[model samples]
Target: MVGSLDWTAAGGAGDLLAPPVAAAVGAVADARAAEIDPGLADTAAFCEHYGVPMEASANCVVVAAKRGGETTYAACMVLATDRADVNGVVRKHLGARKVSFAPMDDATSRTGMEYGGITPVGLPAGWPILVDEAVAAAPEVVIGSGLRRSKLLVPGKALAALPGAQVIALAQR
Candidate 1:
Protein backbone atom coordinates (compact mmCIF):
# COMPACT_ATOMS: atom_id res chain seq x y z
CA MET A 1 0.00 0.00 0.00
CA VAL A 2 3.02 2.33 0.19
CA GLY A 3 2.93 2.81 -3.53
CA SER A 4 1.95 0.52 -6.36
CA LEU A 5 3.64 -2.50 -4.80
CA ASP A 6 1.77 -5.25 -3.00
CA TRP A 7 2.84 -5.25 0.60
CA THR A 8 2.89 -8.26 2.93
CA ALA A 9 4.06 -8.95 6.44
CA ALA A 10 7.82 -8.57 6.47
CA GLY A 11 8.14 -11.38 8.98
CA GLY A 12 6.62 -13.75 6.42
CA ALA A 13 8.75 -12.57 3.52
CA GLY A 14 12.15 -13.80 4.58
CA ASP A 15 12.88 -14.95 1.07
CA LEU A 16 12.78 -11.35 -0.07
CA LEU A 17 15.03 -10.04 2.69
CA ALA A 18 18.69 -10.43 3.39
CA PRO A 19 19.58 -12.99 6.04
CA PRO A 20 20.19 -10.34 8.67
CA VAL A 21 17.08 -8.37 7.67
CA ALA A 22 14.94 -11.48 7.79
CA ALA A 23 16.26 -12.21 11.25
CA ALA A 24 15.77 -8.63 12.43
CA VAL A 25 12.41 -7.90 10.81
CA GLY A 26 10.59 -9.51 13.69
CA ALA A 27 11.95 -6.86 16.02
CA VAL A 28 10.41 -4.00 14.02
CA ALA A 29 6.71 -3.74 14.82
CA ASP A 30 4.27 -3.34 11.94
CA ALA A 31 6.91 -3.66 9.28
CA ARG A 32 5.76 -4.62 5.78
CA ALA A 33 7.75 -5.80 2.78
CA ALA A 34 7.07 -5.64 -0.92
CA GLU A 35 8.87 -7.16 -3.87
CA ILE A 36 9.90 -4.91 -6.74
CA ASP A 37 12.05 -4.89 -9.82
CA PRO A 38 15.64 -4.95 -8.66
CA GLY A 39 16.58 -2.58 -11.45
CA LEU A 40 14.38 0.11 -9.94
CA ALA A 41 15.87 -0.12 -6.46
CA ASP A 42 17.44 3.32 -6.54
CA THR A 43 15.39 6.00 -4.80
CA ALA A 44 14.45 8.14 -7.79
CA ALA A 45 13.84 5.15 -10.00
CA PHE A 46 11.79 3.22 -7.48
CA CYS A 47 9.74 6.25 -6.50
CA GLU A 48 8.97 7.15 -10.07
CA HIS A 49 8.32 3.60 -11.27
CA TYR A 50 6.05 2.75 -8.33
CA GLY A 51 4.31 6.11 -8.01
CA VAL A 52 5.76 6.68 -4.56
CA PRO A 53 6.35 10.12 -3.20
CA MET A 54 9.87 11.25 -2.34
CA GLU A 55 8.73 12.40 1.06
CA ALA A 56 7.65 8.89 1.98
CA SER A 57 10.96 7.35 1.05
CA ALA A 58 13.93 7.14 3.37
CA ASN A 59 17.52 6.43 2.49
CA CYS A 60 19.97 4.71 4.79
CA VAL A 61 23.62 5.60 4.44
CA VAL A 62 26.59 4.08 6.24
CA VAL A 63 29.20 6.42 7.66
CA ALA A 64 32.66 5.94 9.06
CA ALA A 65 33.83 8.04 11.95
CA LYS A 66 37.38 8.02 13.21
CA ARG A 67 39.01 9.40 16.32
CA GLY A 68 42.33 8.60 17.88
CA GLY A 69 43.31 5.22 16.47
CA GLU A 70 39.86 3.74 16.22
CA THR A 71 37.12 3.92 13.62
CA THR A 72 33.40 3.48 14.17
CA TYR A 73 30.62 2.76 11.71
CA ALA A 74 27.03 3.88 11.97
CA ALA A 75 23.86 4.12 9.91
CA CYS A 76 22.06 7.40 9.19
CA MET A 77 18.44 7.53 8.06
CA VAL A 78 16.99 10.60 6.35
CA LEU A 79 14.08 11.33 4.06
CA ALA A 80 14.83 11.06 0.37
CA THR A 81 13.92 14.72 -0.04
CA ASP A 82 16.65 15.64 2.43
CA ARG A 83 20.29 14.81 2.97
CA ALA A 84 22.16 13.57 6.01
CA ASP A 85 24.37 16.23 7.55
CA VAL A 86 27.31 13.89 7.88
CA ASN A 87 30.33 16.10 8.58
CA GLY A 88 28.26 18.40 10.74
CA VAL A 89 25.54 16.67 12.74
CA VAL A 90 26.68 13.06 12.40
CA ARG A 91 30.36 13.68 13.16
CA LYS A 92 29.53 15.71 16.23
CA HIS A 93 26.90 13.22 17.37
CA LEU A 94 29.25 10.28 16.97
CA GLY A 95 31.99 12.23 18.78
CA ALA A 96 34.42 11.67 15.97
CA ARG A 97 37.08 14.01 14.71
CA LYS A 98 36.20 13.05 11.16
CA VAL A 99 33.25 11.46 9.46
CA SER A 100 32.69 10.36 5.90
CA PHE A 101 30.53 8.00 3.92
CA ALA A 102 31.90 4.50 4.27
CA PRO A 103 33.44 3.02 1.15
CA MET A 104 30.91 1.08 -0.87
CA ASP A 105 32.82 -2.19 -0.55
CA ASP A 106 33.39 -1.69 3.15
CA ALA A 107 29.78 -0.76 3.73
CA THR A 108 28.47 -3.77 1.84
CA SER A 109 30.87 -6.26 3.39
CA ARG A 110 30.48 -5.04 6.93
CA THR A 111 26.69 -4.71 6.77
CA GLY A 112 26.28 -7.89 4.76
CA MET A 113 23.92 -6.16 2.38
CA GLU A 114 23.88 -5.19 -1.24
CA TYR A 115 25.39 -1.79 -2.04
CA GLY A 116 22.12 -0.04 -2.88
CA GLY A 117 20.08 -1.93 -0.28
CA ILE A 118 21.86 -1.43 3.02
CA THR A 119 19.37 -0.64 5.75
CA PRO A 120 19.44 0.24 9.43
CA VAL A 121 17.21 -2.66 10.50
CA GLY A 122 19.94 -5.31 10.47
CA LEU A 123 23.08 -3.28 11.08
CA PRO A 124 25.76 -4.84 13.23
CA ALA A 125 25.08 -4.85 16.93
CA GLY A 126 26.44 -1.77 18.74
CA TRP A 127 26.47 0.37 15.59
CA PRO A 128 24.32 3.42 16.12
CA ILE A 129 21.35 4.09 13.83
CA LEU A 130 20.89 7.84 13.64
CA VAL A 131 17.44 8.76 12.36
CA ASP A 132 16.59 12.31 11.34
CA GLU A 133 13.82 13.95 13.31
CA ALA A 134 11.68 14.39 10.22
CA VAL A 135 12.09 10.75 9.31
CA ALA A 136 11.17 9.68 12.81
CA ALA A 137 8.07 11.81 12.67
CA ALA A 138 6.71 10.40 9.45
CA PRO A 139 3.69 8.10 9.79
CA GLU A 140 5.29 5.60 7.43
CA VAL A 141 8.31 5.47 5.17
CA VAL A 142 9.84 3.19 2.61
CA ILE A 143 13.35 1.87 3.13
CA GLY A 144 15.47 -0.84 1.69
CA SER A 145 14.88 -4.43 2.82
CA GLY A 146 18.63 -5.19 2.75
CA LEU A 147 18.06 -6.40 -0.77
CA ARG A 148 17.72 -4.69 -4.10
CA ARG A 149 14.61 -6.56 -5.14
CA SER A 150 12.38 -5.48 -2.25
CA LYS A 151 11.57 -2.64 0.12
CA LEU A 152 10.31 -2.41 3.69
CA LEU A 153 7.49 -0.21 4.92
CA VAL A 154 7.70 0.77 8.57
CA PRO A 155 6.33 3.32 10.94
CA GLY A 156 8.81 6.10 11.63
CA LYS A 157 8.30 5.58 15.33
CA ALA A 158 9.27 1.94 14.99
CA LEU A 159 12.60 2.92 13.50
CA ALA A 160 13.21 5.28 16.37
CA ALA A 161 12.65 2.39 18.77
CA LEU A 162 15.18 0.05 17.25
CA PRO A 163 18.11 -0.89 19.38
CA GLY A 164 20.80 1.82 19.19
CA ALA A 165 18.43 4.09 17.27
CA GLN A 166 18.76 7.78 18.11
CA VAL A 167 16.42 10.41 16.75
CA ILE A 168 18.06 13.79 16.13
CA ALA A 169 18.16 16.68 13.69
CA LEU A 170 20.50 14.90 11.36
CA ALA A 171 19.13 15.95 8.02
CA GLN A 172 19.94 19.00 5.88
CA ARG A 173 17.03 20.43 3.95
Candidate 2:
Protein backbone atom coordinates (compact mmCIF):
# COMPACT_ATOMS: atom_id res chain seq x y z
CA MET A 1 0.00 0.00 0.00
CA VAL A 2 2.84 2.42 0.72
CA GLY A 3 4.86 2.01 -2.45
CA SER A 4 2.17 0.39 -4.54
CA LEU A 5 -1.44 1.46 -5.18
CA ASP A 6 -2.74 1.23 -1.62
CA TRP A 7 -3.53 -2.48 -2.10
CA THR A 8 -5.15 -2.78 1.30
CA ALA A 9 -7.55 0.11 0.77
CA ALA A 10 -8.29 -1.42 -2.59
CA GLY A 11 -9.26 -4.53 -0.64
CA GLY A 12 -7.42 -7.83 -0.54
CA ALA A 13 -6.44 -9.11 -3.95
CA GLY A 14 -8.00 -12.35 -2.69
CA ASP A 15 -11.49 -10.87 -2.67
CA LEU A 16 -11.13 -9.03 -5.94
CA LEU A 17 -9.66 -11.85 -8.03
CA ALA A 18 -11.25 -15.10 -9.06
CA PRO A 19 -10.41 -18.00 -6.75
CA PRO A 20 -7.78 -19.50 -9.03
CA VAL A 21 -6.56 -16.11 -10.22
CA ALA A 22 -6.26 -14.78 -6.68
CA ALA A 23 -3.99 -17.66 -5.76
CA ALA A 24 -1.82 -17.06 -8.80
CA VAL A 25 -1.51 -13.27 -8.39
CA GLY A 26 -0.88 -13.69 -4.69
CA ALA A 27 2.27 -15.58 -5.56
CA VAL A 28 3.58 -12.79 -7.80
CA ALA A 29 5.62 -10.21 -5.91
CA ASP A 30 4.64 -7.21 -8.02
CA ALA A 31 0.98 -7.83 -8.75
CA ARG A 32 -1.78 -5.50 -7.47
CA ALA A 33 -5.53 -5.75 -7.78
CA ALA A 34 -7.94 -2.83 -7.45
CA GLU A 35 -11.71 -2.66 -7.46
CA ILE A 36 -13.39 -0.73 -10.26
CA ASP A 37 -16.85 0.20 -11.42
CA PRO A 38 -18.37 -2.58 -13.47
CA GLY A 39 -19.97 -0.13 -15.88
CA LEU A 40 -16.47 0.91 -16.99
CA ALA A 41 -15.33 -2.63 -17.78
CA ASP A 42 -14.16 -2.21 -21.38
CA THR A 43 -10.53 -1.22 -21.93
CA ALA A 44 -11.01 2.23 -23.43
CA ALA A 45 -13.77 3.30 -21.07
CA PHE A 46 -11.98 2.07 -17.98
CA CYS A 47 -8.73 3.77 -18.95
CA GLU A 48 -10.43 7.07 -19.73
CA HIS A 49 -12.61 7.11 -16.62
CA TYR A 50 -9.76 6.10 -14.30
CA GLY A 51 -7.20 8.39 -15.96
CA VAL A 52 -4.98 5.44 -16.83
CA PRO A 53 -3.14 5.53 -20.11
CA MET A 54 -4.28 3.31 -22.95
CA GLU A 55 -0.73 2.11 -23.38
CA ALA A 56 -0.83 0.75 -19.86
CA SER A 57 -3.77 -1.53 -20.63
CA ALA A 58 -3.68 -5.10 -21.88
CA ASN A 59 -6.47 -7.35 -23.11
CA CYS A 60 -6.85 -11.07 -22.48
CA VAL A 61 -8.69 -12.99 -25.17
CA VAL A 62 -9.96 -16.58 -25.10
CA VAL A 63 -9.36 -18.47 -28.34
CA ALA A 64 -10.78 -21.81 -29.37
CA ALA A 65 -9.72 -24.40 -31.90
CA LYS A 66 -10.52 -27.96 -32.86
CA ARG A 67 -7.81 -30.50 -33.44
CA GLY A 68 -8.53 -34.12 -34.38
CA GLY A 69 -12.08 -33.80 -33.09
CA GLU A 70 -11.08 -32.40 -29.72
CA THR A 71 -11.73 -28.76 -28.92
CA THR A 72 -8.97 -26.83 -27.22
CA TYR A 73 -8.86 -23.39 -25.70
CA ALA A 74 -6.08 -20.89 -25.21
CA ALA A 75 -5.80 -17.50 -23.57
CA CYS A 76 -3.92 -14.71 -25.33
CA MET A 77 -2.61 -11.42 -23.94
CA VAL A 78 -1.93 -8.43 -26.19
CA LEU A 79 -1.51 -4.71 -25.72
CA ALA A 80 -4.60 -2.57 -26.17
CA THR A 81 -2.84 -0.83 -29.08
CA ASP A 82 -2.62 -4.04 -31.11
CA ARG A 83 -4.88 -6.94 -31.97
CA ALA A 84 -4.08 -10.60 -31.37
CA ASP A 85 -2.94 -12.38 -34.52
CA VAL A 86 -5.62 -15.01 -34.15
CA ASN A 87 -5.67 -16.42 -37.63
CA GLY A 88 -1.95 -16.12 -38.14
CA VAL A 89 0.32 -16.36 -35.12
CA VAL A 90 -2.17 -17.87 -32.73
CA ARG A 91 -3.57 -20.34 -35.20
CA LYS A 92 -0.14 -21.66 -36.05
CA HIS A 93 1.12 -21.68 -32.48
CA LEU A 94 -1.92 -23.57 -31.32
CA GLY A 95 -1.43 -26.17 -34.04
CA ALA A 96 -5.09 -26.50 -34.76
CA ARG A 97 -7.02 -26.86 -37.99
CA LYS A 98 -9.08 -23.77 -37.20
CA VAL A 99 -8.77 -21.02 -34.61
CA SER A 100 -11.10 -18.25 -33.62
CA PHE A 101 -12.15 -16.22 -30.63
CA ALA A 102 -14.14 -18.47 -28.34
CA PRO A 103 -17.83 -17.79 -28.08
CA MET A 104 -18.73 -15.56 -25.13
CA ASP A 105 -20.69 -18.29 -23.37
CA ASP A 106 -17.87 -20.81 -23.80
CA ALA A 107 -15.29 -18.40 -22.50
CA THR A 108 -17.20 -17.42 -19.38
CA SER A 109 -18.45 -20.90 -18.59
CA ARG A 110 -15.05 -22.52 -18.92
CA THR A 111 -12.94 -19.79 -17.30
CA GLY A 112 -15.42 -19.24 -14.46
CA MET A 113 -15.08 -15.50 -15.10
CA GLU A 114 -17.02 -12.68 -16.68
CA TYR A 115 -17.20 -12.23 -20.45
CA GLY A 116 -14.92 -9.20 -20.73
CA GLY A 117 -12.99 -9.77 -17.52
CA ILE A 118 -11.01 -12.92 -18.27
CA THR A 119 -7.34 -12.89 -17.26
CA PRO A 120 -4.52 -15.23 -18.22
CA VAL A 121 -3.62 -15.99 -14.63
CA GLY A 122 -6.49 -18.44 -13.90
CA LEU A 123 -7.21 -20.14 -17.15
CA PRO A 124 -8.20 -23.83 -17.23
CA ALA A 125 -5.40 -26.34 -17.00
CA GLY A 126 -3.74 -27.38 -20.30
CA TRP A 127 -4.82 -24.20 -22.01
CA PRO A 128 -1.83 -22.25 -23.24
CA ILE A 129 -1.56 -18.59 -22.31
CA LEU A 130 0.02 -16.71 -25.20
CA VAL A 131 1.56 -13.38 -24.27
CA ASP A 132 2.63 -10.87 -26.87
CA GLU A 133 6.34 -10.11 -26.66
CA ALA A 134 5.66 -6.41 -26.28
CA VAL A 135 3.33 -6.99 -23.35
CA ALA A 136 5.92 -9.12 -21.64
CA ALA A 137 8.35 -6.21 -21.83
CA ALA A 138 6.01 -3.60 -20.36
CA PRO A 139 6.95 -2.10 -17.00
CA GLU A 140 3.40 -2.34 -15.72
CA VAL A 141 0.24 -3.49 -17.41
CA VAL A 142 -3.41 -3.36 -16.37
CA ILE A 143 -5.34 -6.61 -16.93
CA GLY A 144 -8.74 -7.95 -15.99
CA SER A 145 -9.46 -9.03 -12.41
CA GLY A 146 -11.68 -12.06 -13.35
CA LEU A 147 -14.71 -10.02 -12.37
CA ARG A 148 -16.12 -6.98 -14.06
CA ARG A 149 -15.86 -5.02 -10.80
CA SER A 150 -12.09 -4.94 -10.40
CA LYS A 151 -8.79 -4.85 -12.31
CA LEU A 152 -5.35 -6.37 -11.86
CA LEU A 153 -2.09 -4.46 -12.27
CA VAL A 154 0.99 -6.63 -12.69
CA PRO A 155 4.52 -6.55 -14.01
CA GLY A 156 4.62 -7.83 -17.56
CA LYS A 157 7.31 -10.36 -16.84
CA ALA A 158 5.18 -11.85 -14.10
CA LEU A 159 2.34 -12.45 -16.53
CA ALA A 160 4.67 -14.11 -19.02
CA ALA A 161 5.72 -16.57 -16.33
CA LEU A 162 2.34 -18.06 -15.63
CA PRO A 163 2.14 -21.84 -15.98
CA GLY A 164 1.80 -22.96 -19.62
CA ALA A 165 2.27 -19.37 -20.78
CA GLN A 166 4.16 -18.75 -23.98
CA VAL A 167 5.61 -15.34 -24.80
CA ILE A 168 5.40 -14.86 -28.54
CA ALA A 169 4.69 -12.40 -31.34
CA LEU A 170 0.93 -12.43 -30.93
CA ALA A 171 0.12 -8.81 -31.71
CA GLN A 172 -0.75 -7.34 -35.10
CA ARG A 173 -0.81 -3.60 -35.75
The stretch of ten residues in a row with the least summed lDDT in candidate 1 is 1-10
**lDDT by residue for model 1 over 1-173, one digit each (tens)?**
67899999999999999999999999999999999999999999999999999999999999999999899999999999999999999999999999999999999999999988999998999999999999999999999999999999999999999999999999999
Candidate 2 lDDT tens digits, 1-173: 21223343222658887776776666555777787889998989888888778778899999998789989999999999999999989989989989989999999999988977899977888889999999999998888889998888888998888889899999998
Candidate 2 has its poorest 10 consecutive residues by lDDT at: 1-10
Q: Candidate 1 — number of clashing residue pairs?
A: 0
TM-score of each: 0.99, 0.92
Clashing pairs in 2: none
RMSD of each: 0.5, 2.6
Model 1, position 169, has a per-residue lDDT of: 100
Please, what is the whole-model Cα lDDT of each candidate in the order they appear? 0.96, 0.84
Q: Give the TM-score of candidate 1.
A: 0.99
